[model samples]
Target: MRHGKTFGLSLFLLAAGTGGALAQATVVTPLQQQYITAYVAQNPVPAATYGSEFDPTVGAVVPETVVLNQFAVRQEENRNWDGGQDAVRSMLYFVTPTQQTVLVEPGTRRVVYVMR
Candidate 1:
């Protein structure tokens, strides 16, 4: 009985965590929506390469070939991409149709850097 309870609890926690992540992906603030809209307008994905589904894993329409396993938000550090040492806030990492990585600062919704 104790082992069963433990297993059930573990299952509950796992479900909750998955729900939370999915919720975060589907729901966005008004500001975030605006950012997404503007970004999409400026950088449209060609229909031939990507699907219409909005994939939060990469903060953009996912490529037909790639399956997004995870989406991460983290502070920036000095690296080859941006070269900024000060780690202040979090940013969104978007994967392009060409399999390139584009880092966007959520606040400004700016494509700060790219890794090809």
Candidate 2:
């Protein structure tokens, strides 16, 4: 009998095409657990971003209002959503040494106290 690679190939393709859904990678550690905790405490969502780590001895103190302002500014820059539904909470950020500022929305995931 002649060997038939064609039939095997078709069967493989059909099985692969309609066989199963792709599996997702499992996360062993908790995901954004701290941020969730902070959100409940903060109440109003703040525009939060991950920034470069700063030295604690630098004598830089981040205020609450400033964070909110950053949130507002960033939202404006990104043109975040129109209103309702996709609407996101405003937020802000101020880096003292660089004297740079950024604004963004916290979206649905708000953080209370962003800390180490």
Candidate 3:
């Protein structure tokens, strides 16, 4: 009975820790959103043509055929826009046909954020 109680407590703690990590996932702030919008506007790139099958939501994997552009953070803009988070600096972005800017993780090709 004591062992069972210990196991249950351990499981609960593990689950709580996992939840905390998930909650810490990067979130784009309003300022960052504005910066992204302006950046996309200032620098136009060819939009990727993905049919209806493409899912732009977070956690969705981008197809290999689609090219991901490196998000070049200029020194002047980096300090103002990044909010001290290096995640923004390392991400890759691509514009969709609908003009939505999607940030992606380079390694996994997973969509991190889609700015409409």
* Strongest candidate by lDDT: 3
For candidate 3, the 10 contiguous residues with the lowest summed lDDT are: 3-12
Please give the CA lDDT of all the candidate structures: 0.37, 0.28, 0.66
Model 3 residue runs over 4 Å out of place are 1-25, 79-82
| Candidate 2: regions farther than 4 A off | 1-68, 71-89, 102-116
Look at candidate 2 and tell me the lDDT of residue 84: 20
Report per-prediction Cα RMSD to one decimal.
14.1, 19.7, 10.8
What does candidate 1's lDDT look like per residue over 19-63, in tens digits?
333322332333333444444445554422345564434223334
Flag clash pairs in model 3.
Answer: none
- Which sequence of candidate numbers ranks them by lDDT, best first? 3, 1, 2
Q: Which ten residues in a row have the lowest lDDT in candidate 1?
A: 80-89
Model 3: per-residue Cα lDDT over 1-116, one tens digit each: 34334333433343354433342254666656776677778888999877689877766779988888876777787566534235455668999888889987676677766786
Q: How far out, in Å, is residue 65 in model 3?
A: 0.7
TM-score of each: 0.28, 0.18, 0.69
